[model samples]
Target: MATAAIARPQVSDAEWEARQELAACYRVFAMLGWDEMIYNHITVKVPGEDNAFLINPYGLHFSEVCASNLVKIDIDGNKLTDNPYPVNPAGFTQHSVFHRHLPDAHCVMHTHTTAGMAVSALEGGLQPINFYACNFIGQVAYHDFEGVTVRAEEGERLIANLGDKRAMFLRNHGILVMGKTLPQAFLMHWGLQRACEIQMATLSMGQPVHVPEDVVAVHQRDLSKVQIPGGPGKADFDAMVRLVDRIDTSWRN
Candidate 1:
């Protein structure tokens, strides 16, 4: 329950840009059918504070999310802004633990996508069955289902479960991806969830797998390029924001 400082400086230009990117990530998650109404959340650390972040207001659907609609709150789940909307304590509990403990994790994105849940429930979590699957090699963590992550007591457990990892599979639930920037988190979540979907689709075929450890390791190294700043996936975030604008400009309103 770390609280943000009361007299912090105003949002810097870079942070303002991040807020817009994070909002677009939420909308793109919705567009990709990864959102569970307004139940899930994507949070980003506000500039200049290790314990402060911007999260979507609890009542708004992802489609209704706009940059201005995002709420600023402390890692302890306290709202710092003057928005009339109430923060979801349950979602805050889930997000705060990660932000409080992981200093490098600027953006934490979670979703209850069907494919993600399916993969989480499988006997093997994120088996190396596809090229995309290797992107998570030696990096993913798994947290047992704690019955919805609504209580403050769950925070410590969740943080420990996610220790030093960039991706987490909440068993019988969904996925979480942490990144240094909103765009990076969005890209990782995209790959993580899509990898799960690919695994599910391949399993449905019920045939022998083709993954080799050497091959997976190689692909994993190559895919690391996408995670680099200024890579194609990095550019995708800006493009996706424009895509959202094309589909529904009101998200900016």
Candidate 2:
């Protein structure tokens, strides 16, 4: 008989929170059918200084993620934590391009949901087709697809495409949105997802969809005022935590 050998990964408390949130984000997105298998990633800048980021380990389903599962890496893509989970270099390239330059970007959310991919395939990109689309109006950016995004050279192109916007539609790929806080990013993602859903449904109906310029302008103004009154935008965060609790509360475990 042959004996089996195994090695375990170690994660800390700080990394733990990052894992929980990342896992919850995954579970919620999976529940919504927004995951692109294990391809797309959601990364959160580690709290405080040190220039660290946390991401999913390569081979696991999002639903299987937990506080103990995330892998930490530095801006240079070096695995800094004591975890044996292999980091995806291409995934790091996709995420690090933003983290290195975008100081305001703390939580980066990327998804390959059906609606997002459907809209990405359209030559027009995300048009100002409706009010929800207006939330993305001038704020949306675009990145052209450059193969599988595995090359380090592609980082420059990704950065150029992202430019100065917090929301982007990666042509031939999917959607990416960044938030200063998790709730802000998550809310923006909700808008982006809803916009994609509307785009797909409307286009499938085989009818032209139109939004008056004046109406889009009005909603843009309304969206500008759409922040919670005080306290670190935790309301939406709490709400989402509750939603995660309803489905699978073990993310924190």
- Give candidate 2's whole-model lDDT: 0.77
C-alpha TM-score for every candidate:
0.89, 0.89
Q: In candidate 2, which residue ranges exceed 4 Å CA deviation?
A: 1-15, 230-233
Candidate 1 lDDT tens digits, 54-146:
998777888777767678998777777766677887778888887887787888888889999999998879988777788886789999997
lDDT measured at residue 231 in model 2 versus the true structure, 0 to 100: 41
Tell me the alpha-carbon RMSD of every candidate. Answer: 4.9, 3.4
Give the Cα lDDT of each candidate.
Answer: 0.79, 0.77
Lowest summed lDDT across 10 adjacent residues in model 2 is found at 1-10
Whose lDDT is greatest here?
1
